[model samples]
Target: MRIDLTSVFVDDQAKALDFYTDVLGFEKKNDVPVGDARWLTVVSPEAPEGPELLLEPSGHPAVGPYKEALVADGIPAAAFSVDDVHAEYERLRAHGVRFTQPPIDAGSVTTAVLDDTCGNLIQIMRVA
Candidate 1:
């Protein structure tokens, strides 16, 4: 079997949508109202029919602590593949994206980490 979808817990769905779409350049795939939250998802514009990243609401009590711990430890919640890590880093930085870690060559790949502003750290990487 193949992967279908993955998720990133977000503090605010609206802000997450703006960042993931307007900033990160992902395209909205689904947005269905589910009680107090929405079943929102985004997909890479380059791969519209591929795996979708769910912009999950962090309403559950456990999510806050989990996200905090991850951030405290400098761990990324999700990683996105890019054509050039350094280029993407510069572009994002120009758009006011605050990166926790600058792009660094990690043997076979280069990566950088940025705060998503919705309470998560996201990584962008490229094969070196």
Candidate 2:
């Protein structure tokens, strides 16, 4: 089966959508309601109509524990494969994004870590 969807635990759905779609250059794939929260998803412009990143609702009873666990353990941000780690990192940094770790070479790939400001460390990777 083809991998088409993934979820990112977010504190606020609308804000997350704005950041991911407006800031990170992603396009909205879904914006329908699914019970209490809406089914919002975003896709990379480079991979339009490809895999989607779901902005999952946090503060929910079931996912609250997991989200808290990840945040407490300092392992929250989700990663995304990038075409150019340095360029993307620079562009994001220019947009006032805080990066805990700068771009560094990791043999086969170059990687960088940025703070999503939403209780996570988002990693961007690119093949070297």
Candidate 3:
């Protein structure tokens, strides 16, 4: 068995696209309209054919509370692997991204958490 796709609930698809692509460096893979929302997904540039991250609409009632609770508890909505967690964190900070947690060495890995601005916290990590 293999993973094909996963999703992160987003308040706005357009803003999510910009942040995921322009800021986080993911590439848009698919964008098909579906009713009031679109089937928007992105893939890492390094792995165009790999698993896709779906930017799902957060119109559902449960989403708001779920996201709020996660943020309140400092939980990341998604985690992305990077070659260098510190470098990625610095680059993101320069772009005005607000981080909830700075890069910290955590035994086998290093990680930092940043707010996605569209109502989610995302983690960038590197395995040692």
Candidate 4:
């Protein structure tokens, strides 16, 4: 009935942690050690009790190919809502974020895609 947590496969957990928190501004929620990988999760600062994003490791056999295919096709692994797509894009760009696609209107919304640098493309969008 409701979403609690979601995940995106990451090539490296440490780098993803820095980017998701230091750059994108998400707050760290959990960091439990799970064998070789940690059960790391982050939550939006605006809604600390909202759904959490799990930065899962891409060590599984199928994950590498799946991520590669998605990137090759210019697809975003996750989409985050923003107040202003263009403004967010600009702000992120200034912080050295590399966007695969700049903000563009698409019918009812505007979106921009940026590489997460940990092997995933993420999209920031605003409803128009």
C-alpha lDDT of residue 89 in model 2: 88
Instruction: Identify the runs in model 1 with alpha carbons over 4 angstroms from their true place.
Output: none
Q: What TM-score does structure 2 among the candidates reach?
A: 0.87
How far residue 75's Cα lies from its native spot in candidate 2, in Å, is 2.9
**lDDT of model 1, residue 83:** 95
lDDT of all predictions: 0.96, 0.82, 0.96, 0.97
Q: Give the Å shift of residue 72 in candidate 4.
A: 0.2
TM-score of 3: 0.98
Query: 122, model 3: CA deviation in Å?
Result: 0.4
- The sequence of per-residue lDDT tens digits that candidate 1 reaches over residues 32-118 is 999999999999989899999999999899999999999999999999999999999999999999999999998999999999999
Against the true structure, what is each candidate's TM-score? 0.98, 0.87, 0.98, 0.98
Return the clash pairs for model 1, or none. none
State the weakest 10-residue window (summed lDDT) of model 1: 119-128
Error of 3 at 40 (Å): 0.2
Please report how far candidate 2 places residue 116 from its true position, in Å. 1.9
lDDT of 4: 0.97
Instruction: Tell me model 3's lDDT, rounded to 2 decimals.
Output: 0.96
Residues 23-111, candidate 2: write the lDDT tens digits: 78899988999888999999988887899998888866767677667666656368888889989988998999888778999799898
Q: Per model, how many backbone clashes are there?
A: 0, 0, 0, 0
Q: Please state the error at residue 42 of candidate 2 in Å.
A: 0.4
Error of 1 at 84 (Å): 0.3
> 24-122, model 3: which lDDT tens digit per residue?
999999999999999999999999999999999999999999999999999999999999999998899999999999999989999999999899999
